[model samples]
Target chain A: MQSKSNNSLIKVRQLTKRFDKLIAVNDISFEVFKGELFGFLGPNGAGKTTTINMLTGLARPDSGSIEISGLDCSKNPKLAQHLIGIVPDESNLYPELTGYDNLCFCASLYGMRKHEREERARDLLEKFGLSDAANRKFAGYSKGMKRKLTIAAGIIHRPEILFLDEPTTGIDVASARQIRQLIANLHDSGTTIFLTTHYIEEAERLCQRIGFIVQGKIVRIDTVISLLQPIQKKHTMVISVLHPDEGLHHKLISEFPEYSIELVSKGQFRIVSEKVINIGPLVRCIEETGGEVSEARRIRPSLEEVFVNITGIELNAMKKEKQKNGRSS
Target chain B: MKRWIAFWNILLKDMRAYYLKPPNISWGLIFPVAWTGMFFIKSGKGLDSIISLLPGVVAISILFGTTSMLAVTVTFEKKNKSFDRLLLAPIPLRLLMLAKTSGAILFGSINAFIPIIIASFLADISHVNWFALVLAAIMIAIASTFLGLFIAVSVSEVFEAQTFSNFFRFPMIFLCGLFFPITSLPIFLRPLSYVLPLTYGVDILRGAIDKGNIMPLWLDFLIILGFCVLLFAISLKNIHKRWIM
Candidate 1:
């Protein structure tokens, strides 16, 4: 990734958007510096998409100001549109056009010359692993191919900043991983990105700084390392055992008083502690109690824990939404 | 320079995605000829009356072609959110909208000629003012396309667009003197014909084809031009209010 700079490529302040009685984005403010991958981390309806819409001129804000590369876009939101690219939550390219045509059309909208757009489109198709499908109509592309082409179209003009609204929400794991890698490559090449996603792991893996927003309000904004600082000292482990019962649970709780132990399910238990857990004594105690430890694994503290702690929303809720979005898309 | 490039690209995209499709192309061709045939049979007028029927047939063809295309292109794209991509383009909203409507305008203008071409072979249209006819066809296309745009902007669904479009289109077909002269209408309904832009567009077409204009040629052209601007302005305002917000 490119080294972070102090130059702010996007600055939004006191931004508020209301739809009838509901305030979709309420008084949110943040800055994304040049070449930084800034994640607007939020669950469903947390104003992440709404904020991106306002910034990209897709929607107007009821109040507040937005400045892109020092150009005031408070009233005329399209002033900085030339300097930015947006990949909407859904693939918005023409379904009838071929992937190559879609990219060339988008580049043309950015005023790229014919030869330049065709070359760029070809390069993007190859880079996105879509050369094989270049001539196929977009309607025939799989979900993953559609998304990759959408990203390629977003960057066809090499805009200074890119706004990605849930770029990999519903794709398969392999495709999602490939997209993340591509996004990292884009960041490495020095394109500032404003990414929004409900996946805490995605934010943890990619973003330099993260902002946690919930219910149309920003709860916290900090560097990923700083955000993880509070949970860094804690350790969590999940152990699966055969013939687990309440007796073993109570005994383990009493034996490991310093650790928080809970029976997660029929054959599993979880143990969490602030200090590094010593497995020898805990395993020996369980074995002595005639319980067989089948599998024991350590869980890493990640942005999931930080998000839960800061926003007080259950991770299961996010997972349910992920599944919902996955099915719908 | 960049704005014009974007505008041209957007227009080309719409042509490729919507206008030039085989279904729409065949529909455009068949609909105009079908409408012309239906009017000819209904009027019980032989090929001898083809010149008098040309103006009304051309006007109706452009009206339906433009309205139906915009109904599909604008409302469907808005529903699927592809129009949002165009909205994000660096071009001004006015230019963006103009780019979007251009394909429909071109389509409608071409549709206007189908009947003219058919009529030219059957009737001696040698005395017709070809320049005035072409200009009238283009102006009629603009007015009707903007009317389609206004309908598309006011509604959210494609079905709603069709219904809303019919609310204006069906009335203009009779009230605009497309089939009959506005002077022959009841005085009470005469004002309604004047209020519809298609009336002036048909008048210009009638003047060019049959020397049957009630209003002066310049006045008819000016009124159609005014209506185009008015409809376009209203559509743009509605787009910002309903779609952007």
Candidate 2:
């Protein structure tokens, strides 16, 4: 792809990483614009973490280049890391140290002055709703508090770019909401955010451009609106039936060659069509097939459907059950 | 200058988290003093005899206590995965190693001094050479702690690091002329005694207290200093290979 704009804060090309015999990230290329919340959407083993590790200085890339703010970070990580902040999936912090001290120590790693770090740490503690627990040891805090403190530590130095891996993977709903709010506030304050997650709704709600990575390859990269635009004309109407025949899915598929019909459960079926789907054929086909439709309504196409359509796999199978929050977490 | 500030911060954090703990301090002090005290009782005590035991006991304190402390601290971080935070920082890996080694050395010196201060008034100091004694103590601390650091970074688990440290440390105590004169060792073991870094360190301390030159202070200092450099270099190389690359 050619340069779409000159204001790209991060440009990656031909990036690849291999662990023994498996290539974790393979020849993937993308650019994150300034102040853009770019989401790398993929399943568990899709190499999202591997790509982030290479972008930061934690691991070396086997081939290709990563230019962050015009510097070759893969080759010169020390200089690049100075301008990037990392919040790894795990909240890796000193458990023995208090929350306040942990923040101070992280700041000190970047060579911040004592007074400056103290002020920043206090402000972050208050902002993250951790002031009451600031004096508590990190190990003693709940999972939510630990996650909040880890994020606070990441932004202590105010780096130009922030890399968050699975930011809200496992946490309570309230904490996840607060973390998302913090992330939004950071984006609003003009800090570029690059995050990876398996949550389709998270990518849809937060990211301006979402990249779908499957098995170490990027399948597509575009705005959420554009990705969903192709499915706009397709109707995914859900119908309620008093009787559902087991053979109805195949019979409908054979009759309407251009539409996908699926039995969502025993009493419900969904029909996806390329054009306006008339209920006359479906109702008549169900009646002839020993099924009765009690009601029907058009359901909006969710990002989950878009993802499943693009990847040919259900979104629930890719993520853990506990990682699923209703809408945004 | 900023690099140095970061170095100091690393040292300060490790010192607070690991070195300042009561269990860690006591572990470095208890055994060395107990063994020496037992020996003093068996030898039918005299001020001179008690003073002679000080150098060997202090050397043992550094060998066992400092090495174990450094190993345990590092392995704890590795096992718990907290060390990842340090790895992501922008500072060079070598500087972090320097800060950790320096903190371990400082704690080792303090641990060694506990017995010496108590023995100071009990022993006859008019015949002692304080300058050479202090120099030998500092050298022993550096060599032992850096060697400890090498073990810490080379192994994947805490038990493995401790086992590797003791695999080398236990032999040195027996062969390093700490318990007896080097001439008294069997001919085969005599060469082994000279090869151990603790041998020169113990000899220097003994020579200082006795107001006698064992092998010329300069030669012994150079040997211990050489051991320090070799151990520190190996540690840095291992840490980079294990964590950085």
Candidate 3:
């Protein structure tokens, strides 16, 4: 994968943000290039939202600088904000307005002409499958419909850089899939997308480069392939044998010294290796040992494992900890 | 030109959202008309006394209605985080503030005229100086709206804005001689009334209605202009700080 600095659309240098005494985002720096789908991966309270807030000019950073499309956000907030669109964590759609009116309002803020705003809003509403609900008030929209409307509102002006915070949270699976497809299409059309999601599968599928933020600091930033490589190296292979003998397990471990063999009840055995390579060797060894191999399959590690390995705690555990802290506080 | 367009957009949207609604229209018209009717019934004098008090009552209504409405709406917007969307927009902060103040002023001006228009048919308003009274009422509306915007931006919470407004609202309404003549009050309180914005509004309102010259024409105009400048300056300063920081 190419480095984001080469085609950098957004750049942050030594960014630090503090709310009173508590430091929300510690010293951190990263770049997002144009047309790259960048994933901001973190557990709850990991400063993803704070980073987005600063980048979008919603909140002032305590120290450091942020540049959007080469415009300094701190110095030229209006100009910088004009180049970016944001879908915040919470759906901030004006409930009193209809879906179409919400987009029109955003277009008005961008100083678009009335006819142009109407045309663009119509196009976007159709694109997002919200045409039927265009005239319906947002207060009556379902969660998924509201999410789609908010997404449409954010991108109404066609900004070059887009910030989405948990764009699929609290939505049904079908809506999540639709949103993911929309994001993919946007990225394919050359829009730089900076998104934060708790769904590891979504991140793995959608992100070109992923940053793992922990404790208000980025612990790791790498491509999805690179981030998953360490855990992916450990492949688990299950085999069903014709003979249920202790001698077969010993023979397999001896013949393949690199593989760890575990005997199961009846005629099943599990083999673990650093990688899914030389499965033929195990099959050959089983044939030589007078055992019949019925099935062979390799299972690679998932993104969940990669995340746990990097953070030293599962997402659920972190959430539980946060819940405990909340109760105590 | 862009600023003007933005200001009109905000004014029109606010008018549609809050003013055209039945409940708001009823509140704006009914409240002042009820107050005027009760005063007329209680003090059933000739048309002169009732018309003399009309300007002061309109000024009082504009101050109370405009300030409370703007302050409360801004507070609600802040609480709902909707203000963040406006702050992030490309429009200048000054223009946005101007838009909100203009909306409140337009609503307040309408509210001030609602009762007076109804009372005109029943009473003798031919002697009332309509031009001077309308001009003074418009100035009072602008001043009150700007002050409301200033208070809205300065306070962190809506409740605090409400409490702080009472410090100015009640005193301006009562001591500024909205319901009765300031000359009826004791001598000490009379000087303080001259400093209130409503005092000038009432002076102009009554001067035009009753054809009375309580103060010189230039002095009343100067006082209203001074209040407008002061409130506008405070609102501008507050908005600049909010946007830049």
Candidate 4:
């Protein structure tokens, strides 16, 4: 039998890390295939950044191993780093340096010759749409401009694997759209991307495989279709009603014990169940409670719903925590 | 060849960011020259007194200028998060530190050079052994640069790094026999002077320029070289252990 890691470009086994007494990453194991865009979705303080740090050689794992392109990362991270590019969440490029200079400087750190570094720097500036601002100091760039410059800097060396942490957590809609398109373009060119994001829709759109991490451990990993498939039985029904009474939710729950009913508003209700719920019966129950059903339809399961199901925590709760942590830390 | 290229890239970037600025370039020259002028006025046209002060003045310039520049570089990067890029690079950490040290040496040596030239024309320290002076100046530059690296890696913030730089540098000026001869120091204080790198540095500089022998010239040279190696190793170890992650 062949080993499971045979075709994987990155293989991690029982990886763990600690800061003082706190265990930041705990025995996590996963594999990322070559040229695959894998999304590591998690809330704040869920060990996502810590795991990335260990994998990128910014920090060492206290236990286990990581292999990248058949290179043992734990033993020879310098060699491993040569094959990877990392875009940390913050724009950490030199503020005093011009956009062109930052890209050139990053290329030079990878030991690129002067002529090639400048050439590539100019190319990246044009590609990222920063050519007009190429000579302006990075300190003067807007947040979106800084983000583009940072991503350009990371890829200056043209590594095979790229790691991006929260590439678009907070930015204007247009700029965010631009960044997503750029990421997709990079992936199309055969670069394996490992991205972490709080935006479930972003992950569902970009990732070929998605991993849900919670409390420092990966709860589940699967393709987008596979993740949604297992939760198909958990269906939701949004019904438009007339004169919806407050007691209608209690009546529906009492009559249909297996179903969960919630009044979204006076004239709207959301009904959920683990099995295919019969809206025919729900309509009768609504009428008995003196409400007229206007519209009823099943709502498809979103990645957010799947994430909420897998992590056993509300998605909004995680977003609030992410914002708080972003502020304090 | 690749490592050298990487090193030069880092060196070039740092020079453009910190050492290449006009204010900084002038600061290195003005500081030592100003101190030398003060000593010249106090000595009242006695060429020997001013000349003796020249060696100590030049040595102190290299010490303060190099150490402060490096400390500022490291702490500023830490504050602004650019240090993360350096730590994440594929090159060995030692090479990065070496590149930073080399830049500091170049800046510091130029700082020492200005005073030597000014003193050569403005004040006469007769019978100067040009060879000994050149060698000693080079050694002082190397040693002071490494000392800068040592202080830089010990702190995490800009204000703290500068505070610590002064905390250590202020004492060295008086205790390293820069302003006073080592023999003039109390017997108990002589041991303290011997422990400081600047003591041997000043000994070499003063020995060469004054044409007076405190110890053998080669002994001073050996000691200065040893300090360079020791301080360089410590700085490299500190940066690797703390900053790499």
Predicted structure with the largest TM-score when compared to the true one: 1
Which stretches of model 4 miss by more than 4 angstroms? A1-4, A238-248, A255-258, A262-269, A274-298, A322-329, B45-48
lDDT score, candidate 4, position A11: 91
In order, what lDDT does every prediction score? 0.90, 0.84, 0.79, 0.85
Q: How many residue pairs clash per model?
A: 0, 0, 0, 0
Q: What is model 1's DockQ versus the real complex? A: 0.81
Off by over 4 Å in 1: A1-6, A247-251, A284-291, A327-329
Tens-digit lDDT track of model 3 for B64-141: 778877887776676666667777777777777777677788888888887688767767787777789788878888
Ranking by lDDT: 1, 4, 2, 3
Model 1 chain B: which ten-residue window has the lowest total lDDT? Answer: B42-51
Docking class of 2: medium
DockQ for each model: 0.81, 0.69, 0.33, 0.72
Candidate with best lDDT:
1
Q: Candidate 2, which segments miss by more than 4 Å at Cα?
A: A1-5, A239-243, A254-258, A264-268, A277-299, A319-329, B45-47, B211-213
User: Which one wins by TM-score: 1 or 3?
Assistant: 1
Per-residue lDDT of model 2, residues B1-245, tens digit only:
77787889989998989888887767766876797787788778566577778878878887776788888788788777678777778888778777767788888878777778778777866777879888888899888888888888888898898889889898888889787778888898889988888999998888887744468888999999998899888887777667654
Model 4: per-residue lDDT, tens digit, A1-329? Answer: 15545878899999988888888888999999888999999887889998888888878888999999999988767878888999998899999999999999899888899999999999999999999999999999998899999999989999999999989866667787899999999999999999998778889999989998988999999999888886676889899998888787777778888878877667787888888878888888889889999999989888888898889987558667656544221
> Could you tell me which residue pairs clash in candidate 3?
none
Q: Output the lDDT of residue A51, model 4.
A: 85
Query: How would you encode candidate 1's per-residue C-alpha lDDT over B111-145 as one tens digit per residue?
Result: 88888888878999999999999999999999999
